[model samples]
Target: MTEDFINYYRENISKKSQIIKGVNDFLVWGKSQKINFAICTNKMESLAKNFLKKLILLSFLIILQVLIPLNIENQIQDI
Candidate 1:
């Protein structure tokens, strides 16, 4: 279930996640070019923000988009 995966992500996956090679350079290049970057994810807003923050990439993004249905949002909120 969603809750199980979320729990697992929090406990095991988040800390181990790695930034892709060149992402920082790419973001830097994009910034120099006056391009804006955003993260569009199925993850909850807080989770997505935390993940990005953990990777030190949160500052590169101007927007964080969490695309989840109302029911899933409610379920995540409840948990």
Candidate 2:
């Protein structure tokens, strides 16, 4: 079941935007309800932290991609 969930996420929801949005929504809902959240993955703490950092970076990149044209075209014009 764990593998299946991971596979489904990899195949259908690999985009960082999706991951970030899902996590963000969950956190917001949890906070509103005063619910504490904890991650229980089998992954090591370092690995999990790295994964989360990557997701955050990807989400930030996606946001920049959308906003750069309007706000910083001069900086990223080469790309």
Candidate 3:
């Protein structure tokens, strides 16, 4: 499933997906209203950036965050 998703993202996302209606306008409006905006994704950092780049929205975006999980044991250190 992961491979299929990755393959589809690479092969089709840039070529096929359409932005939802009013999306850019919404973002702009949000900014005008002093509302912060962000793009959050579970995908790898590179993939997320590439997606924004493909959408031609990278330059307009303020920030995007990708949440990657780390091993629980690595999350903290006990002395």
- State TM-scores per candidate: 0.78, 0.38, 0.60
RMSD of each: 2.3, 14.8, 6.9
Decoy 1 TM-score against native? 0.78
In terms of TM-score, which candidate is strongest? 1
What is the lDDT ranking, best to worst?
A: 1, 3, 2
Extract clashing residue pairs from model 2: none
Give the alpha carbon lDDT tens digit for every residue of 1-79 in model 2: 6556544554444254445347677666766777655454443233344555656532222112122243434432322
Error of 1 at 24 (Å): 0.9
Error of 3 at 37 (Å): 0.5
Deviation from truth (RMSD, Å), model 1: 2.3
- lDDT for 29 in candidate 3 is 85
Off by more than 4 A, model 3: 1-11, 71-79
- Model 3's alpha-carbon lDDT is 0.68
Model 1 residue pairs with clashes? none
